[model samples]
Target: MHLIDLRTLQQFVRVAESESISRAAQALHISASPLSRTILNLEARIGFALFDRVGRSLRLNNAGRELLVNARALLRDNERLMLDLQRRAGGTGGTVVLGHMPGALYNGIIPDTARRVQAAHPSIRFQFESALESEQLEELRRGRFDLAVQTQDVSDPALASRVFASERYVLLMPRDHPLATTAEISLNALVEAEWVVTPERAGPSLRSAFTAACRRQGFEPRVACVAGDIVSALALVAHGFGLCVAQESLVRFSGEQILVRALPLLEMQTVYRIVWRVDGLTPAATRFLEALAAPSKAATPRGQRKR
Candidate 1:
């Protein structure tokens, strides 16, 4: 048998983990043909097919299953060696792949946290990725990312998530809108206005909360357009497309054109959490999380909340 080729071995490992050649190629940032060729070459050298095809899907063969177990161990050792070398050369200078919901990134928390982490640990690199919450969880499960910041709990009960901050939700509208002058508009009043919302998958809990709140108000919301991110939501509001409900942290990005206020009838809030695979955290990921865990000294004063 030909000796193991680490490059081909690595590709095979990714394919096995993702169970889809196309997905593996996308995650590795390579074309499908090249990834397929690598796998074919490795299988040919070993004189046995590594995967069994079933319709449009593939499953590892017995030999492939055995190789995968060893392959993962080898990959881990390889990573350890690289990390050690990097540490010796300088310090913790490696990319920490982070996935966050689109809404969080536009609201400045992700950028601010990333800046602070970089300032504290210059050598630690970051790859900030914006995605839907479901996509984030899937990537985290597939070993594509180091960490994820999300506003809702994923359906998976085993994944570990830590609460980073608790922020209250508020309604946003145009400055001259009738509801803008009220200290707190009732949810029933919101029912008469068109609503802009985040994707359901990204903010399922928030969606549920909003829907339930509307039920309590005796009418369902008239959804206008579902903006994919917070910035888009704010943009829609600025254009008078629809009113939006968002977290108080969103106020950081609000411009003079938009107005924010509390909803007297809707007191629901969202707890933003940092999630990651318990077993897949890298050294940089650990350090960044430690920084996030650090107590915030810049919090708003107790008696005053952001308007």
Candidate 2:
């Protein structure tokens, strides 16, 4: 009965995620033979086989699946402990990695917050990565990101989030389109109109919610293109590929070719949140979070912006 080291647990998690010793070794910059031996040793130490051999591939068995969850939590705790120790030893500078939805960048909230934090604490560095909602959540849990700005609230007990801004959904279309000049538009009125939408993925997606809203109004949206993010969707709309539903703040990036109309009938709002793990913030990350929560004199209220 011996305790497994963090390095061994990390190797186990990587093997479980990639499902192949060779692939995990490639990723870990090691050779397959040694990685395989490491996994065998870990299983021997735990007194259980963690994976099921199926042909050339391996799948996590029930015990492996349970261990995977605990392993991730333990790794996250270890990371936080190291960061805390560094801070106590008078480490004043560190990078705060932020994973965010594209809207946060397009609307300038994340950039503004970063500037404010850096101005006061010049030693702190910031890295911003834009990803889908589901990707951001996964990365956060894996300890890859210190913070995230998402469109929807997260319910995971491991993370904490608060709404910092809110914006309504608006219809984006080419300025020369038929509906561009219309004083009012309804979801039913766009029954024949084609749309540009985000691709459907796990977690709460704008596409799924928008599609359901369209169905409640007696029509399914005719998707003309599937864009990865709102910026791409706005570009598609600007080129007359199709109309799109996006956050109102995103209209700032639409240029002159695109017109934005209020989607009052749809009654959708994108709530921007500052999300972080409960005990996972490094010293720099904690400072950035505090700066984000403080009211800024140079910033405009996102929810009160005129449509």
Candidate 3:
């Protein structure tokens, strides 16, 4: 029987991503000769040339593209299987995979609920991933993530969501900022300020909302920088980089250097929801969901600041 080794598949995928065997080898900390030999062996076993040599570059053929997709799926399955086996061997309760939107941790509700579940079920394993709402939704649909937490509404009928927590939005800026002196900053007043926002991968929902709010104030927002997450965006604001809209719970980080101001005209409420598929859930996920159903207190999760 012919079989593909996980290691070989790994190298193949790495090469496919890097588009160069040498670069893949360097990234994997291995020699190029062996890596090239492994790819050739894989091509032979698969009865097709996976790569076409274009001068010095290795370009994926149609077969290679298809194989890469299946390879990734197989690797994900292998990882999940290995983790399940490890959990069983360790006498653990079970494993729960959770994904949440960027800056969901800033409000502390998701992590707090997670902590409660972990405390009650010490034997169970909890896997957490922080990503954009779109990424979380895609992963949830793919069965990669068991649950997701985000402020945006999930439009899919297959997924079910309920309000988990709510917080008002506040403008965050440097204490020395001209607008910091105001008791409450108006949306129109912020038209001229450079804004820092989360990266595009964070989804367009919030950005669109901010834009609409600005437009309603008769001016387009001037974005200065795009950060990886709301936390990072707020950090940039704290360092006098630009301004960001933060949740009311984030006020604890002001520290006399950053200022928090409410916007009455653009009063925005952040509504967080715990989303999961309508299909069956593992006992561990069910328990976690049950715990998460309650009105989450603003308790900070472990390793998170009280924001």
Candidate 4:
């Protein structure tokens, strides 16, 4: 038997799974011609046809089905070897990519946590991107991230996550609004109040909680405007457009003219979780998540006073 190269084997697997060389090449970040050549070479080594050419598509042959099983095992081994090599070269000094929801960024934890990671691991670099909860989870499954912080309930048993903190939704109104004077307000009283809300997908769990609270009070929120995220929603409150229910993370950006009061009747809470892949994490990624769990310093804007 001819020697089988791992790279060629991996390309074959991608092509089989995607069922198209174009898609496989795109996923592997290579052009179609080189990928096609690699697959041909792999077939030559195996001495059997892996795929049958149809009019415009390629269908996996019986041999392809058998090879795919071994291909996956080999690819997994390669990944393990790469992870081991990365850790051995540097214990906790590399790039750690993190995904988080926009609300988490406003909660002050994102920056505070990142700052902590920098302090503890000076040589480690960090990148954080705001994404929807589902998108973050999907990317984590694809092995595209080192960590993710989101404000939704992750029910997937295959993934590992820990709740770093819980944030309650506070009623935000214009400073001069009649409802702003109360120390706390009941959700029942805001039945007719025009409200601004975040995107539904960004906080599905929280949205369900808020809707249920409204239903219990015999009313649904009169959504006057739907903002892109918490920041935009709060900005609407600042401009006297309407009231909004924002997480504690948004407390940092609410203007001075906006009043934040606790909602006594509603049981809306957002949990910020630090999630990573179920497989073993690199030393650098592990250290970064540890810092995220325990913020090393208080997070405050450069020119703002603590609330």
Off by over 4 Å in 3: 1-92, 183-188, 299-307
lDDT tens digits, residues 1-307, model 2?
5998999999999999999998999999999999999999988888999999997688999999999999999999999878666763443567889998656665566788888877876667789897888898889989999998887768999999988777667888898998877888865568988999998977777898798878777788898999977778888889999888887666667888887788877677767888999988777888877777888753443533344
Q: After superposition, how far is residue 129 of candidate 2 from its true place, in Å?
A: 1.6
The stretch of ten residues in a row with the least summed lDDT in candidate 2 is 298-307
TM-score of 4: 0.64
TM-score of each prediction: 0.63, 0.66, 0.63, 0.64
lDDT agreement of model 3 with the native: 0.78
Worst 10 residues of 3 by lDDT: 298-307
Clashing pairs in 4: 106-249, 107-249
Q: How much does candidate 1 score in TM-score?
A: 0.63
Better of 1 and 2 by TM-score: 2
Find the candidate with the highest TM-score and give its number: 2
Residue-by-residue lDDT tens digits, candidate 3, 1-307: 6899899999999999998989999999999999999999998897889999987689999999999999999999999889876754553458788897655666676667778877876777789897778888899999899888878778998898888777677677898988877765665568878999865533645676677777777888789998766667777888888888866766765566777666676767777888888894667777778887766554433222332
Candidate 4, poorest ten consecutive residues by summed lDDT:
298-307
Better of 3 and 4 by TM-score: 4
> Clash pairs of candidate 3?
none
Q: Candidate 1 — which pairs collide?
A: none
Better of 1 and 4 by TM-score: 4
